[model samples]
Target: MVGGIAQDDARENRLIDLFNLHQAADRVRHGTDAILKLDNVEYEFELKSATTNKGGISTVRDLGPGHIAKWRGKHWIMAFFEGSKLLYCRYGSPDAMRPWITEKWDYIKADFEMAKYVPAHITLDTMFEIVGKKEVYTKADARKIHKNQMSAAQYETAQDTVEGYSPARMLDIFKDRARYVIERGSTLNNPHIPSKYFESWPEIRTNHAAKLRELVSTWRDAKP
Candidate 1:
């Protein structure tokens, strides 16, 4: 059920089978009496660029069938499991369905993205543990992260989550602060806000209102 593919993707290329596909077919046919035989199935293949010196890798996956759903302005695939047993799967956007693999498939010939689900147990698990061990942000670090102009990711994350202040409220606060900076374009007003907020606030050019509108709009619509 599970295998891998290597070598260039061309019809002339030969595949050295590490696992037996025919055997799996025989077992499923004889053992299940055709009940388990796949009538209509859908497969998704992915290709990804490798970061390593080697050109890249490929991956393949099979998802029997699934229904589609939409979330957050994008479509997603959804699959349901009955009490942890394997059910069926459907595909949508990343927001929707989670992917799974069958045991009989060959993975070596798969495209990079498809193969990504193949676990690199050592490296990936080590990295997972390493991430948890990293230092948590100090108060100063948190301030530093937010001090500059708000990044798109941060803005988007804030918008999607319920724990944070509402977007409208945050927008009002940012506009108020920006307006204050624009009005008091002199050194005397600089002392009021923390220096970290801006690299010594830029002098208010003639287009203060236009500039504020542009900046607010940019932050509002950005993706996380």
Candidate 2:
């Protein structure tokens, strides 16, 4: 019993050390050392009681990563870690993460609460279809956009040699537009997104950006 206790303590200490190292590295990478703090790290290493299946006649095992199990009449499970919090969204496979982050960040931000504006029946497959229709801009597109913006500088110089626009300034503007297009197109093409949630995309993105940044910062600062 004493040996078993010592082994468990050693494992716990190792995990803590690993988290500390991750937190330290994040601080340097994101320049969030000032605002981020490393707090106690806790994780659920086992599947929750509610997730398990046991019956008098038969016993079906709980699902692990990449494994499928039936839950609440649904066959699929989508799981991901938000900081140290392990979240499970039902009725979807693991591939749902991309669509979830791209199309449903606002919904997830509210802890999956069904509010007046939020859609209650939007399935993960629907989100995946929405994400699929949207074009993901490639590096080639970026280069083409940059080239067109730079060409405008030549036209400006010919029209007014003395007051010509700066190439760098034009490039900055074009880059911003490109980013906006990439961000906006995803949501704009999805007609099912609620107007209220769509309008709040900027706020949602900002909050998530900060949360992710802090999460990384803390993880890197961890001392494993």
What's the lDDT for all of these models? Answer: 0.26, 0.30
Please give, for residues 1-224, the per-residue lDDT of candidate 1 as tens digits: 22212312211011101100112245321121111111242212111212122221222222111111111222111222233332332222222212212211122224322323322222423432432322232222322334545565555454423444333334333443343343223112111111132222232233433443343334334638
> lDDT for model 1, on a 0 to 1 scale?
0.26
| Candidate 2 residue runs with Cα over 4 Å from true position | 1-103, 106-162, 188-190, 193-224
Q: Which ten residues in a row have the lowest lDDT in candidate 2?
A: 43-52
Models, CA RMSD each: 29.9, 21.5
Error of 1 at 94 (Å): 28
Q: What's the CA error at residue 198 for candidate 1, in Å?
A: 2.2
C-alpha TM-score for every candidate? 0.14, 0.17
